[model samples]
Target: MSAVNDTSFNSAVFLLTGIPGKEDVHLWISIPFFLIYVISIVGNSVIILIIKTDPSLHVPMYIFLSMLAVTDIGLSMSTMPSTLGIFLFNYKEISLDACFAQLFFVHLFSFSESSVLLLMSFDRFIAICNPLRYASILTLPRIAKMGLVCALRSVALVFPLPFLLKRFPYCHTNVLSHSYCLYQEVMKQACSDITVNSIYGFAVKLLAVGLDSLLIFLSYVMILTTVLSVTSSTESIKALNTCVSHVCAILFYYLPDIGLSVIHRFGNSSSNLPQVVMGYIYLLIPPLMNPVVYSMKNKHLRSRLFKAFCK
Candidate 1:
C-alpha cells in the first residue's frame, strides 16, 4: 500500500499544468507578470536609493521603510526569477531538493516581510502618537536589533521545512504547480502518510502567520487609539497621515497571508488551483503594491525620492 502510494506521489503525473486547453495563454500571462516584476524591483530599488541619499528622511519611519523595501525585494526575487524563466522556456522542471530549498527561503522571507511590516506599524505608532518619545523608543540600535530579531525568527521558523520534507519518502510526483515549491502542494505528492507534514505545517503557520497577525493587529490598535486622542486637528491629521502608507502596506501584506493560511487549512487539495493562483497573486502583488502605496501616501518619501533622483 505504502510503496504504491509513494510511487504515485513521486510521479510527474501528479503535476498540474496549464489546463489542457488554454496552453496559448501561458505566453500572454507572462507579459503582466514580467511587467510587475520590473515595477517591483525598480520601485523597491528607488526606495533604498532615496533612503540612503536623503538624510532628512533618516528618522525611524524611513528606516522602517528601507527595511520593508529590502524584505519586499527579497521575497519577490525568490519566486520571480524561476517563475519568469518558465515563461520564456520549455523545460520548466525543478529537482525536488531545489524546489524545497526555494520553498524554504520564499516562505522564510515572506514571514520576515510580515514581521518587518509589523515592526513598521509599531514605528509609525510611536512617531505619530508618542511623538515626544519616538526618537528614544526607535533609535538606530533598536531598529537594527529588531531587524536582526525578525530575520532570525523567520529563518528559524522556516528552515526546518526542508529538512522535514526530505524525510518523506519520495512516492512519485516532483512537478510543482505554479513556480516555487509549496508545503501543502508537495505534501500531497509524498510517499508517506502526510499527517505528520500537515501537523508540522500547521505549527509553522502558528508561529509565522498566526502570531505575526496578532502583533500587527495589536500595534494598529495602539496606533488608532493614540491617533484619536489628539486635541489639535492638524496634529491628529498629520499623525493619521503618517500611518497611511503603513496601513496600506499592512493590508497588502496580511490579506493574502491570511487568505493562504485559510486555504491550506480548510480548502480541499482538489481545489488547489485557486490557491495556487492566489499564492502567486499574493506573492507578486504586495511587492509591486508597496511602492505604489508608499509613493502615493507618503509626501516625505515622495519628496525625498524626487530630490535624490533629481540630483
Candidate 2:
C-alpha cells in the first residue's frame, strides 16, 4: 500500500485489467472480443437504419428500439478502445481524466438505455391496454420530448460523478478490475473517504437504474393483468407475443447486470476472474443479441432486413 498523502490527484494513472491468469492468451482472447464488437456495431447500425428509413416503422415502439440500438452502440464503443488496446497493443495505462471521461459516457449510455427500455414498456402498455388512444397519446413530438427528458435526466445524474471522483486522492493500487473504467471500480481505488461518492453512486443507481427497473416491472405486471383479461386466449397470446422481443431485451440487459452487482457486492478478490468475465458479458451480449432478437421476433423488422440483404 502506498502512503495516502503521497499521490496527487492529477498524477494518478489507472491500469485497466484484462482477464486474470489469461495474460499468455490475450491475443487469442482479443479475437472473440473483436468479433463481438464488429457484430454489435454492424447489427445495431442495421436496426437503426431499418427503423429510420422505413416510414411505416416510425411508430413509438420502433422509435424506442432505435434509441436502444444507438445506446447499445455507445455502450460498446465506450469499452472497445481500452479493451482492444489492452489486449492487442498492451496499452493498459489510462490517465485520470481519460478514465473519468470513459466512465461518464459508459454510465450515460447505460442509464439512457434503461430509460429507453422503460419508455418501450410504456409504449407496449399503451398499445396493448389502450390501443384506441395510443396514437394520440404517443405522438411523435411527445416521444421526442420523452427521449429528451430521459437524456437530460441521465446527463444530470451522471455529470457530477467524474468531478466527485476527481476530488478524492488516490494512493491505493490504481489497477482497475476490468478493461474499462467503472464508477464503483474507480471509487474503490481512492484513498480518501469516499462516503459522499458511495452515497451518490448508490443514489444514482437507485434513482436511475433501480427506479427504472421497478417501473418496468410494474408496467409488465399491468400488462400481464390486461393480457389475462382478454376473453380470447388467442388474442391474449398474440398480445403477449408482441412483447417477446422487448422481454428478451430486458432479460439480456438486466440479468447479467444484476449478477454483476451481486458479485461485486458479495464476492472477494478471488472472484476477479468471474467479475471480469461477467463484466464482458454484461457489456457485450446485449448489443450483439438485441438486433438478432428483434429481427427474428419482429415481422416488420425481419421482412425489412430480409429485403435489404436478400436484394
Worst 10 residues of 1 by lDDT: 12-21
* Candidate 2 Cα lDDT to native: 0.93
- TM-scores across all candidates? 0.90, 0.97
Tens digit per residue, CA lDDT, model 2, 7-43? 5656879999999888889999999999999999999
* lDDT tens digits by residue: candidate 1, 33-95: 889989998999999888887778788888888888888888888887677766655347766
RMSD per prediction, one decimal? 2.9, 2.0
Local accuracy by lDDT, each model? 0.78, 0.93
* Candidate 2: clashing pairs of residues: none
Highest lDDT scorer: 2
- The worst-scoring run of ten residues by lDDT in candidate 2 lies at 1-10
